[model samples]
Target chain A: MEQTSGTQRLVLVVEDNPLTLDAVVAALDEEGYRVRRAVDGMDAIGEMQQEVPDLVIADIHMPRMSGGELVRRLREWNVPVILLSADTNWSRTAGVVFVPKPFDLDHLLDVAANLLDEG
Target chain B: MGIVELLGVRSAAIVPLNVAGNRRGVVIASSAQHDFFTEEDLRFLQAVARWVGALAHRAELVQQLTAEAAERGRRLAADELVTVLAHDLGNYLAPIKARIDLLRRRARREDRQRDLQDAEAASQALDRLRRLIADLLDVGRLDQGIFAISPQAVDLSGLARETAAAFQAGSNAVRIGGESPVPALADPDRLRQALENLLSNAVRHSPEGAPVHLDVGLEGNGDGRWAVLTVSDQGPGVPPDLLPRVFNRYVRGSGSSGLGLGLYLASRIAAAHGGSLTVDSPPGQGARFRLAVPSGDELSGFRGEAP
Candidate 1:
């Protein structure tokens, strides 16, 4: 099992697209990380209320609160974010990794690994 | 003057108000007494015309600014709509990609060669679709000066066969014929994508049961030695009016149920690889697309005519 900070790492993936969420969660799970799923930013917030994750991967556009809003809320918290975006409007949020849509799964895994390792 | 005399006007002074080279209007002063109007009165009228012109200029500026603001607002709304739509389309593509990745992983783990190849092909096709969705925002990725390829010596004939095998399953049958060992310095995945786009376009246009054909070979001329892949179909060829701009972004045929990105992206992929994608269609015969890249020896590091 993979460990970060001397504990099992938890990654919360927030995407309105069900398949993308499934893909991200599955890929992270394959890497031996504990992954949580959320449909949008509001859902992500609900998950955070239960437990704050080590890392958050969220899409920019969604039904309820957007990933941008979610990142804004997490600004007070020290959790790192990986913003998966297909929209050009994705801003450069500090301490957030940006991955364009239709990305290679390996590349995304590498990014997640680097983020976790660096922390 | 005759009309003025008929109205019993003895003296008349008319001034054409020319302000900033624009003739605003005419001011007329008449009196029963001859030469009753003075130059001072005419000068005053001309000054008023100048004031009117100044007001008119300001009003015109305001109108233009309003129009421009409205146009900008419209443009912003349209852009937002397109981005939202493109993002939704991307969301739909995500699942297909996820399934493909999982299939690929499983195939590799099981050592199923055929399934692995099929999954890889599907992944590449999804890659092209993702680009098409992105192109909805950028219109022409080339216009943004975005052209990058990872090139190596690859067998063009094998690529053609694999591409044909992966693509020719459903709507129409594709027959492959070409010379083997046709090597080129190109990105195999991108090259295959371009070929698939052409093949699918052929399939879509062809009548039921007409086989789409893919052929690969080598050619040489003053341009240079080249490895070429050609896809042709026995369908109603491209119309003459659309031929010149066939590869232009967003140019679609009548009743085309596509985003019109396939051919444009294919052409861009070819150009990025320092190659050309040309189409030949004679009236009602059919369409033949030829894609050619510089020839290279397998693993020779021959960097002739590569981008």
Candidate 2:
């Protein structure tokens, strides 16, 4: 069920939990996106330095730098961000979509696709 | 003695004041003329003394009642704290333990990711449990007048927005609108926790999809400036009889679960920051809670040093 016919769009998945990181990357890959993985916000920033992704998905709570700090840093890149958080009080930021934990993979992919398409 | 001597009183009738069968003092009546006191006059004087003793006894009774009521309130609060702690702990730990068990059973490499996710969920649940325990302890420390808070400059509006945003999911309808960058002297963590408690309560009581509004701004005039945050929800309004005691520890309104310590702790946090928490609810119209802390020049001398 590959959705993209041309060069696959790249998506960066940043999460501290190895399991969540693996699952998100697998899901995005299955959706026909070139998925790059980062263990945390710092690694994600380094990955971005090498090659900016079309969309960045990061967990809100992470070691070293937080997803929020990453989002602020990515403001200049003008890339869409999807923040995953277990905290209900997570602060909302402009130009970012927040998805709570235990989210449906299809729904997340739809949101990612819509954002990437808009971008 | 002096007045009687000046009046040239030849004699006086002194009766001991007795309250609750204990002698407290005495009452004295005198006449200027010799042999001025009659048998009937002595009886009237004794009667007056009895009335005064009765008044003293009544005052003593009132004092005892007030002390008893205070003690009763504290015991009730302690009891509620224990009950809520047990319930909330079970609520969080049961799921975490179950998830851990699931992880233990699912050991295949292919299931590794799912297990890890379960572990992460369990970890988050543990964090929530920790926070709940901390809140319970804070309430206790605050009651004993030993809770410490370190105050610094904080952005009230940003905090309100952030706290409100955290509850936007799971049947919560929250709207945050007010002046941004509103600054005040406060313990950022404590103030945030207080606001979170208010937001949590508001969301919990609100009808499904009913909007909960959080507004923050600068209030008061001149030297009395205050940073105010108000959280309102369209839930069943608090009962009129329960409104006054809403901040009292262990006082719960109808349809509320938990130990009823949330508002009490929030109120304590506000007081620690030289602020106040208040609530208003008209029957059938929902409830609104306001928290106000001194801001600007008013907080120049504010040092919320932890006790």
Candidate 3:
């Protein structure tokens, strides 16, 4: 689903559950950014292959590939990323950011805007 | 021997200690005089030596066993902490956060009443999280052997419907059946939590579009009548190896997502109610869990009228 794209920032939200994917994508769209969705890391990677997203927000655990692996690969791709999870131990890479799961919607939106300098 | 020679021993005997069926070392006794030991003394030393050998072997075996047990416990705690904390909490927290956030967005743009429409849904999700946290706290209390349940005359059938309804929204795949007014003596809240655990487990493993079935009824034998609730799923059955310890805390199957507290807590709740929770899974067939508790009757001072 394509959001407003007014800011024209293409944010890709990757997760396993469809409901969560829709929820986050809708939020980003409402914030005047275009959004894409992926079911998991592998799917997100495939999306990146087609067209690199300006920003990425992903969950850490999923089938096939995880968001952690995706973040590691995104380092070379130069995409600003936010990893989300209920996890306690995985570390954020340099230039990469994180959002804990059950994250506040406003906080995530602000973090994305700050990363993209939307303000 | 070198030490004995240095001590100028004129008489000496050596005994080999067998540790775990292998000779580990020798014990030697020496004296300066040739008449230091009588024949009986030598025999006694031999007998004592055998006993020492047995003790050495037993000690080594015990050390190895302790190490193995500790390693197993360590692995389980690690797996449980990392996976359960992430997967189980994630199950509720992530989705709840996502849904609420979406609703907030909708409310901002549309009528506030629009978001209020889903308030019940969000509240239910919050309640689920509350129950999870409560169960975790109960687990700690259980460790202290002080966890308690407040039993009531609950209509098992109604409880099943309410409990199943809470988890049935997303997929609406839960199917309920059997006797409608199954009555039992149980802590309604805790009993509902146990049923929720079973339903959650069933829904998770069930393939998309598969049905999760919950049945409420009664069974009887010499032990008197009991109310029984069974939750079954069409998902791939529980693995054979995990069958025995499936209800053990931190005992989750490969690729399972959840706190791993569901079954363990459910079983504990069952026991607390003087009931039992059991599972039967045949290969290639989905798993079925049975929860049974003593029934409530008109003569038992049940808060609800006997059905």
How high is the CA lDDT of each candidate model? 0.79, 0.75, 0.78
The docking category that best describes candidate 1 is acceptable
Stretches of candidate 1 above 4 Å error?
A1-7, B1-36, B140-307
Q: B25-58, model 1: which lDDT tens digit per residue?
A: 7767778898887889778877776777778778
Cα lDDT for residue B27, candidate 2: 86
Query: Candidates sorted by TM-score, descending order?
Result: 1, 2, 3
DockQ of all candidate complexes: 0.41, 0.03, 0.35
State in Å the error of residue B207, model 1.
29
lDDT of 3: 0.78
lDDT of 3 by residue, B54-78 (tens): 8877887899999989877865675
For candidate 3, what's the TM-score of chain A, rounded to 2 decimals? 0.87
**lDDT by residue (tens digit), candidate 3, A1-119:** 32444478888888887767777887777778878888988888889999888888888788897555777877778888888766533443566677766677878887887887642
lDDT of 1 at A63: 82
Task: After superposing candidate 3 on the true structure, give the runs of residues whose Cα lies further than 4 Å from its correct spot.
Answer: A1-119, B1-132, B298-307
Error of 2 at A89 (Å): 23
Deviation in Å, model 1, residue A13 alpha carbon: 1.0
